[model samples]
Target: MTSSARPRRRRRDRDRGTYSVETAVLAPVMISLLLLMVAFGRVVDAEGAVDAAARAAARAASLERDATSAESEAQSAAVRSLETEGVTCRTSSVVIDTGGYALDVGVDATVTATISCATPLSDIGLPGLPGSKTLTASWTSPIDTYRGRQ
Candidate 1:
């Protein structure tokens, strides 16, 4: 090849490798960011589900006459809600307190999710990133004092 053609060919070859190198360097970062976003979204969604479950449970608890049934109802609601959101609940608990004519309900949920960084150059592994989050919600409603009064 002529000197001019040689230089042109060299430049083209250099550029040809640059794209792949750039992609290799940037792909991981891009994938990590995407995984982070997905993890954050999962946390938010789980929290929302927990809140919804807590509210439902609290409403049920407020109408109940004892704390045992209230806790049972709350746990059931939370588990069902978490399942619907595709998140596993590592632990869940509900506490109900009654004083005078007031009822207070507290619900806690520990949520977990798996996030995958699906990129050609990503270093994150197949088990994906494991994330855990906790959410708590509480509600207080006045108990009916005269419901069974004569």
Candidate 2:
């Protein structure tokens, strides 16, 4: 090889390893960001499911005359809705108050999710991470309307 060609060949060899180094530095950051996005999406989905369940339960309670049955129906609705959305419903609570001529329905749901990533650097250890999301929603409707008093 000519003397000038030798320098050009050496430069190409140096540049060849740079791409790998850059990829190594950037890959973990990208992966972590993607995982965060996925986690956030799951949280949002859980919240939406909980909200829908609470609405359904509240509607049922407004129509029904029995408070005990209304609460049970509310809890069941919340659990079933969350499970259908691929999130495990760890616990659920529902409260219905029929005092003051209005019925108030409240629901709280605890949901857990498992997220896995390709690299350990992006692995937010499942136990310590915020893997569970708690969502609550409440609805108030006039009970007297159903009873025909008002």
Candidate 3:
């Protein structure tokens, strides 16, 4: 019994450091995976924010009666929406299609708004990840057919 126990103890002692070595090798991989998930989550969040901003801008513009004011309102609405969502864009742009304003009052018209934003991800410093991602979203809202338009 003593002889058998002696060999078992020696084997256990030899394998003691294996866990440390495995952990040493796998720790970075686990950390990298975690960072990758974070980066992905940020991108998804940015996309959702952009989508909402576009929707808000289009809705705001559709409420306006003139092309000039519609564009102005759309731009402000887009900016406000992004800010409200806590998304910090490196560069942001809003494009408003006010062609619907030119249509007759009784016609079915729609206002389109496109929101573009550059989201920064280089701060994460994850390998193989892009330094920045550009996200764009467009939304169209129908104007009230019976409403007056200039």
Candidate 4:
């Protein structure tokens, strides 16, 4: 404690390597958290896109006058919606259910569109995760009771 002598170092001052040690301990955890967030975000985004596609396809199908046209329109709508989001589908499929066409006026019928998409995320290289994830979405639109049946 003499004026000429160096002051006694506090315990905190003695630890010059603490930052490196803390960084070494925290780097992997931080990196892992970041990667998990990215993957989760991708999945959420894909889900939203697929849901939108399903809704669009169902609406398009409901607007069609015939089963064939409905099917085609549904497929096109689903594909276009997904593509607009820049989500690549390894193998995408659209199925339209036309059972409601048989119902008569005053009865409700539904146009249903189911879209299944296989998106690859192998590039992320996360262990225990599948190379590809299948995302499926379905939507139903009610056909107008007065609409003509075909």
Candidate 4 pairs with clashing backbones: none
Question: For residues 2-75, could you state the per-residue lDDT of candidate 3 as single tens digits?
Answer: 99999999999999989999999999999999999999999999999999999999999999989999999999
Per-residue C-alpha lDDT of model 4 across residues 22-54, encoded as one tens digit per residue: 999999888878877878888889999999999
Error of 2 at 89 (Å): 2.1
Q: Which ranges of candidate 2 are over 4 A from the true structure? A: 100-128, 144-150
Q: Could you estimate the TM-score for every candidate?
A: 0.64, 0.68, 0.95, 0.85
Candidate 1, residue 127: Cα displacement in angstroms equals 11
* CA lDDT of each prediction against the hidden true structure: 0.53, 0.54, 0.95, 0.87
72-123: candidate 2 lDDT, tens digit per residue: 6555665565567665555556665544323332332122121211112123
3 against 4, candidate with superior TM-score: 3
Error of 3 at 42 (Å): 0.9
Better of 1 and 4 by lDDT: 4
**lDDT winner among the candidates?**
3
Ten-residue stretch with the least lDDT total in model 1: 110-119
Q: State each candidate's clash count.
A: 0, 0, 0, 0
Q: How would you encode candidate 1's per-residue C-alpha lDDT over 78-115 as one tens digit per residue? A: 55655676655555665545342232223322221112
lDDT score, candidate 1: 0.53
Structure candidate 1, residue pairs in collision: none
